[model samples]
Target: MSFHYETPLVDQSELAQARAVMGAGMARILGYFREDGARSIRAIEEAFTQGNAAAMVIPAHTLKGESLQFGARRLGGIAESIEQTARRCVEQRLAPSEVGGEVAMLRGCFNETLALLESAAPPSGTPRPPMPGLAGTRPVTFGTAPRTFGRRTG
Candidate 1:
């Protein structure tokens, strides 16, 4: 397999696979990736500040997996490097500062991934299908109270 360095910004094949599997839920899935990626970045920062090597591994690993899933090859590689470095620190074979540098690299890659994904995403006017369990429900308009199930509130 080619490394992230050689891979494109987004792997159409993986995205096609995701669309095939997720169907109408694909929109939400894409949203989740963006939200989660940002959250993972924060988590990594917190773990690094606290000197929690093991904790660092969790977010980096998560970011790596998510990036790969989204076809963000370079970002995935950077995250993977960070994850490995954090693992090494946890094993006492390396210093946390070593992982810190990798984190900086990851930040740059992450920003690129976000920009690519934003451009790839559907336009704002596109309508999203309701999620499962909320099917057939009407959306509450602005200035209107939310509807309750099986009862009405004054």
Candidate 2:
């Protein structure tokens, strides 16, 4: 049997809600990145690099939730690993060596996921669909930036 991957994030209805929310914040979304998404990723990487597990966990959790909401399954999966590892380290006080291994794993996962997301193409021969209810609204594009819409607490 061929196996298929399923995303753990939003369903179609939830996605619609997420899109509506994101549309409302379209003007401020890019600015949220500060450095066009690079800064946020760097901050997350540095937190992991420094062994600040709590910080790493928080950022990863936030990124994962947002990514899932926006249909970014691969990125969300990578972030989920980071979050899980960080949580293990922080909550269970895992050994430094274990945490180091976890960090390395997360880095690899993130890189691979990023590569896949970057290479993904829009469905061939299909025109891009218009955003629901966004007619006449200024179109906002993130270009190559990875983004998602979802709730984040804290």
Candidate 3:
């Protein structure tokens, strides 16, 4: 495995694999990634603002893993960089200020990655076959609310 550093901004093969694994629900999975990624970016920013090097580790690490899962190599690379640098800073009792530039760049990377990810998602209104092994469940698709089977009672 070459790892995220050597990978492109988005590895199509890895993304295809993710698509294969996520099946009809891939769009929802991507949306969740976007939400989690944004939260992680904010956490990283907050850690930098507080000058808490240790605080950056968890969010950065989380971002790095999630990013890689979706083939967002550049975002993963930057998150890994922040995570590694923060770890060193914590070990050496230094501020995480050195990563200020990267911290600033994280949002932009995330936005770009979001675009790439969105583009990779299944186009709206694609028909979904029924999910296996889950009785009485509906497959969620984009641009519409998930289907409900039982009669509504509110």
Winning candidate number (TM-score): 3
Better of 1 and 2 by lDDT: 1
- Higher TM-score: candidate 1 or 2? 1
lDDT of 3 by residue, 12-54 (tens): 8888777656765778888888898999999999999999999
Q: Provide the global lDDT of candidate 3 against the true structure.
A: 0.85
- Model 1 local distance difference test score: 0.73
- Which regions of candidate 3 are displaced past 4 Å? 1-7, 124-154
Taken over the whole model, the C-alpha lDDT of each candidate is 0.73, 0.53, 0.85
Clashing pairs in 2: 70-149
State every prediction's TM-score relative to the real structure. Answer: 0.65, 0.47, 0.75
Regions more than 4 Å wrong, model 1: 1-7, 122-154
TM-score of 1: 0.65
**Tens digit of per-residue lDDT, candidate 2, span 55-152:** 77777777677556545565566667667877887887663233444344444444544444333323334344556788789866766645556864
**What's the ranking of the predictions by TM-score, best on top?**
3, 1, 2
Task: Output the lDDT of residue 10, model 1.
Answer: 69
lDDT by residue for model 1 (39-114), tens:
9998888888878878888888999898887677778877888788788888985557766666666666687777
> For model 1, what is the alpha-carbon lDDT of residue 116?
73
- Candidate 3 TM-score to native: 0.75
